[model samples]
Target: MPAERVCAVIPAAGRGTRLGLGIPKIMVEIADGVTVWHVLHERLRPLVEHIHVVMSPEGEGPFRALAAGRIESGAVSVSVQGRPTGMGGAIFGAAPHWDAHGTILVVWGDQAGLSPVTAGRVVEAHEKGLTIPLVPMPDPYVEYELDDDGTLLRVRQSREGDECRPGGLSDVGVFCLSTEGLHEAWTRYLDEAAPGARTGEVNFLPFLPYLSRERGWPLTVVPVTDPDEARGVNTADDLAFARRAHQRWAR
Candidate 1:
């Protein structure tokens, strides 16, 4: 059979609360005189067929700026989810429109860290099966901020995902949700889940562990050897550090 179609879903709706930049972290300037994700999308387009961006309800302007003077007048599409709603909600908002038989790539638009080669590597892994981009956080000297049991929890406030793999899988926001798994999760969530009791948000990561258990989905972790190729923008400080790292690595 031919190669599977790659339809990408980029979640760019986060509030960037830690940045205190009064703007979404995705809009932050990096080298090349463009916002960070701009560079990412430039490298990513050649490898994928369609690109869908999920942004905050109030994010149309900044998101549009990221695509300035591009030939992708029709190739890119943007959708806004009403809530700061978790990453899960953004994907759900766009589910009805996603390609059912194609592999769906989920990436954080704020992560301007992938080399074109590394981006191709993710697509290669996706073609194989369920996969996640793993990376050793650059601040190695500081020691990871882990749980009491020494697991690297992605977030402190909502630390819940379990370590199905031994070393506690490192999930860089770049994820490859297989078509089968994506459809399975979408169907189950739409059929069984009630709106969130409080913020009415949906959490997508829950489905990863659940589908892995329920449908024998093989969730595999593909660790990125170069840490700089997998960093994410969360704060102004992180941007500064990554810029330095990017400059060093780019050359």
Candidate 2:
């Protein structure tokens, strides 16, 4: 079979209020002069044809400055989301800038620990359709409710105050989305859904179960060996942990 045409989208519009960072979370330095932008871009470069980063209007300038070399080379591009609409909105905001028909590898910008090998697994698993990498986490930020046969029944967002089951399978913030008819599906989802009760935003995770059970899209969940790969830098403590973990991993 021909190699699957792949592209990547990084929803980086968040202002990092929870992180108490003056800059966008993606721009916060993890290593010496290395931000999450550099980390995610380096890991994804080998697997994707191009990368599109969805930034807030104010974030676009700093991000572009940080990615100047790639921007000039056409390997990276930026799109601005006009408002704080959440992940699904950020993804949808970049729709006009990239190849709409190809499989989209969506990775949250804060997922700095994402390794090239795990990203490759996500790309490889795309042959099974919509692919998601899941990690076993003690206190999952997001949980996947599955049936006996391992079909994903629902996604519970603990951050949004959803009461999730104990010791659940959490997403590692990586997904290979099959984009065929995706716009229509998103439009339908927009019409049928309401903003999250706690966050008050149109979330993207729920769309996975929507695609699986409602739209009949085949969903494949790839189990991640290292739970640390699910590390996301959402707060100051998270950043501190990532710095320490990164140093340890580098040795």
Candidate 3:
């Protein structure tokens, strides 16, 4: 009931166990004044109608407190992921908030500074019928080298042109899906896969090649230049990086 055109689901349930912090990683303060998830949800709210935040059972308390303090431009809700099923499961937790026939957008809990303008272009791509927003990684790049625990290193996608070529779109954390799109995403990639499966987290990126091959579902990647648009906080370092980027944006 917030915004009619879209809904955004943020999976914030993962423990930042690697961050060595006892609190939920998503709740960690990345800036002088904001948490990573707050920046993410705030920026994402205007592009969609409603925002559903998925938190682990252990996380619901903090997340609720966090959401309660925000001036949500869109309708905001929270759901508890009852188990540690994986990324797919955290995402599936937000399904109840969606109607069976509308569009939904998704981002990770730790992500910040995604450009709403680019998000809008992604929506336009969907209006034209692309199942996924295939955003072209910027020409000059800031690549995030994420690790099992920390972001290992970041290089320009072009700089690593061999593994991730220039002009080759790397999978960023933002995804917009229809209600049917959300269901399809869950069914096509997650349902058959075992719950708690390691690859269950393959909720987004892995689907692209298959989509390109089979359904011809157009994956549109609107061009984005600032690598800040795709920053996701995993460790303290990433949080620091995103915080600095966000400060620059506020100015």
lDDT of each: 0.65, 0.85, 0.61
- Pull out the clashing pairs in model 2: none
- Supply the TM-score for candidate 2: 0.95
Query: Which residues of candidate 2, in runs, are more than 4 Å off?
Result: 1-4
Cα-based RMSD of the predictions, in order? 5.5, 1.5, 7.3
Q: Pick the candidate with the highest TM-score.
A: 2
- The digit string of per-residue lDDT tens for model 2 on 1-251 reads 12337779999988989988779888999889988888898888888888989998899999899999999999888999898888998898788865554788999989988888899888877774588999888877789987776667899997788987778899888988867788789999999887888999879998888888788788888889788888899877889988887788679
Off by over 4 Å in 3: 1-3, 69-74, 128-168, 181-185, 188-203
Better of 1 and 2 by lDDT: 2
Best by lDDT: 2
Q: Per-residue lDDT for 1-251 in model 3, tens only?
A: 23566777788888888788877777888676588776776677677767788888888887787778552544688888887666666766667776543676777777675666776666656752333333455442333333343222222333223255455444457766555554565577554432223333444444433444344444444556655565567667887787787777788
Better of 1 and 3 by TM-score: 1
> For model 3, where is the 10-residue window of minimal lDDT?
151-160
Clash count list over all predictions? 0, 0, 8
Candidate 3 total steric clashes = 8
- Write down the TM-score of every candidate: 0.77, 0.95, 0.74
How do the candidates rank by lDDT, highest first? Answer: 2, 1, 3
lDDT of 1 by residue, 115-219 (tens): 767667777766545676666653331112233542333321123322233233345567776675566566686666545444464556545545555555665
Measured on C-alpha atoms, candidate 3 has an lDDT of 0.61
Instruction: Locate the minimum summed-lDDT window of 10 residues in model 1.
Output: 154-163
